[model samples]
Target: MFRISVLARRYSTKPITSYFKLFPQNFPHGGPPQDSFIINPKHLRREYRNLQSENHPDLNGSAILNSEVVSNEASLSEVINKAYTTLKNPYSRIVHFIKVNHPLHLDLSRDEISKDLIKKFQSKSTQSSLAYKEILMNVLEVHERLELATSEQELEELEVENEERIEETEAEIADMIKYEIKDWDELMMTAIRLKYWINIRNGIKEWEPGKPMNLTH
Candidate 1:
């Protein structure tokens, strides 16, 4: 199991810079420099617990530090919780990575990836543009099918297929991030696809007979 004690010791005398810095083990290349997409969830959870334990405001109260440092510890504790959440989910991790390293590549926001945006992308001929459009279309198709699905078996079959799609996209994302770092456009499109697939997976998991599908981008 991985622990955050190394990170704590390394930064004990200095101000913590970024959330990514709190878990050096997860991104050995250092924050945005890390190219890999996979992380061990078990390790992440363990590291999170260790980090929270060391940084929790109660653990670093005024008895051990000045008022200013205690206040900062409270804020740091909150940030530690958020960092754990962002790094635990692959989709959010990708978003954070791009936001930090390649801000311009995020062409579309969640609200912008609707029917109107799909039609707009159709006019563009770039590979990334086409790929984004195809992903959006597929997500729409799946949404329609999910809304129309009548029986548990139909939903189950869709769940299996969508899970497979999610796995395939995850692998593609890992390869792209590792070897196609310069292809920001393609990577962004693939990341968007993965996001939608994850949303669909959640919708399937929460499905209830006769209830409308609740798939969010």
Candidate 2:
């Protein structure tokens, strides 16, 4: 279901600027695509370090940037840094890979909208259908809470919830990839949800990292 092939690859190609490109061994065929997004941490870290050093202006190596062109080295270094940063985390890594390689959309099945928890969406629908309204409602709830959460306590709770959901989504992604399922609807749904919650958390932190969030009230 997930990307065993990608991680199992023996070798990879050299990447240009795309963060996913740095770890060609992870996805030799292409970025994620239909494969799993799981990458070995050791591989990623090693590649990141190598890329940084290779593109770094201070480093006097074969990857030497054009000294004649002012700021050329600096520009190259910045891009490399950005790429590494994005690919380091599973969340961002998956997002970046899919965004760059796959632009198509897949939705969750109807039976998936409802989860295991009672008073929830599970057992509420059938297979091969989408829970459109329920999905919209949940997304709305995320935005509402994001805009209203100001207190540190509130932020903490929100973080916990988001973290759990992210883990849940990732687990689902792994399972689906392992199973080698055909329809990607459920996988896409989880990925999209994780992306949304992650953005909400980042936006909040950036807008009110140290400031008193109680003012949001």
Candidate 3:
């Protein structure tokens, strides 16, 4: 087995930015490719265990003598943990993929469509103009419905519908990447819409009657 500890030791001085590269046996392409959107959970878990076994500080025994080695091992272990976690969850994995490949597309700071962004979209009827406007309208409608839901049944129905939409969008993302679709504006907007849907899902989970809707973004 190619040991992750070696990589950790070699690059210990710097941040381990590429988590996928740390586990070559698992992620041969460095990161999950567009075609393979989600990894098999069991396979990922096995690899995570193997990597941790080789690099975990507590298991390193006498290697604790060298403070530098211990520090590096500890850091490596943390990165490994984060890598496993990020890859395990679907939403996080999608976000990570976008951030790594199309970084400029994802803006975590701004959730809603800004006036400037809307202007940019409205300036001309591009490939994603109609789709983007539809999504924007859908977002507003979903939020409004959520806000006015008087019964759990209404919220549950909304949840089911939104979950279906999320699944469809996820497939769209996979297809976009697999086919090398270059409409980055549309792709970015789709990802941002997913973020909103996820937040809405969370708010639905935390719903309370007669309380202000705890929706963010």
Candidate 4:
């Protein structure tokens, strides 16, 4: 069986700088990079312990004379903390995976939202944003269709279709994000679609009468 304690100790003993090098791109915004090495909970806990041990000032005693040791240790600990945070949560893990591996060329532009649609979304009442409401309706329609799916083959087909829709929607959102589009009308529409599919996917996992909820739930 894998052990988190061993992994943590191993990582912590390495020079603090080494951790940053392990995931340099992930820390573009700040201090130290997260521990991307963890692939499972066991690995996660091990890394956590290693970081705590190495950073504890008392461990070094009088052996190290540099004042920077404290700061470095603090930074290392923070990285471990962020890693745990990302790995522990399913949604965060998905987002992190997208950030790390998805193609950067994915467009983020306002062009995906036509002017007529924007007007419709903006003109609606506040009960729920018009765009979001529509997206939810779409999701519901798809889900109902999925429920009526006749066979394993039919269900598989629907799953493929839904997956395609999600991919297309995500690409549209990427375009919007890339261009820094500030149009609430456009952003909300894309966000609504994204959230709708996410919920639908989660819902499918629990559709069976007595099955336990999936990790996302």
**Candidate with the greatest TM-score versus the true structure:** 1
Pairs that clash in candidate 1: none
Q: What is the C-alpha lDDT of each candidate?
A: 0.66, 0.51, 0.63, 0.46
Summing lDDT over every window of 10 consecutive residues in candidate 4, give the lowest-scoring window: 101-110
Model 4 lDDT per residue over 81-155, tens place: 665565444334334433332222111122332333334565665644664566556766777765665556765
Task: Arrange candidates, best lDDT first.
Answer: 1, 3, 2, 4
**Residue lDDT tens for model 1, 70-139:** 3444775676677788878777777666655552323234444323334444545586467676777899
Which is better, 1 or 3, measured by lDDT? 1
TM-score of 4: 0.42
Tell me the spans in candidate 4 whose CA falls farther than 4 Å from its real position.
1-23, 26-134, 209-217
| CA lDDT, candidate 4, residue 191 | 49
Q: How would you encode candidate 3's per-residue C-alpha lDDT over 70-174 as one tens digit per residue?
A: 354467567668778877766667666655564343332343323334455555566557866787788778888888889989989999998888777777777
TM-score per candidate = 0.69, 0.52, 0.64, 0.42
Question: Which candidate's lDDT is highest?
Answer: 1
* Candidate 1, residue 202: lDDT: 84
Whichever of 1 and 3 has more TM-score, that candidate is 1
- Give a tens-digit lDDT track for model 2, residues 33-65: 444566677886776676566434334433224
In Å, residue 38's CA in model 4 sits off its true spot by 21
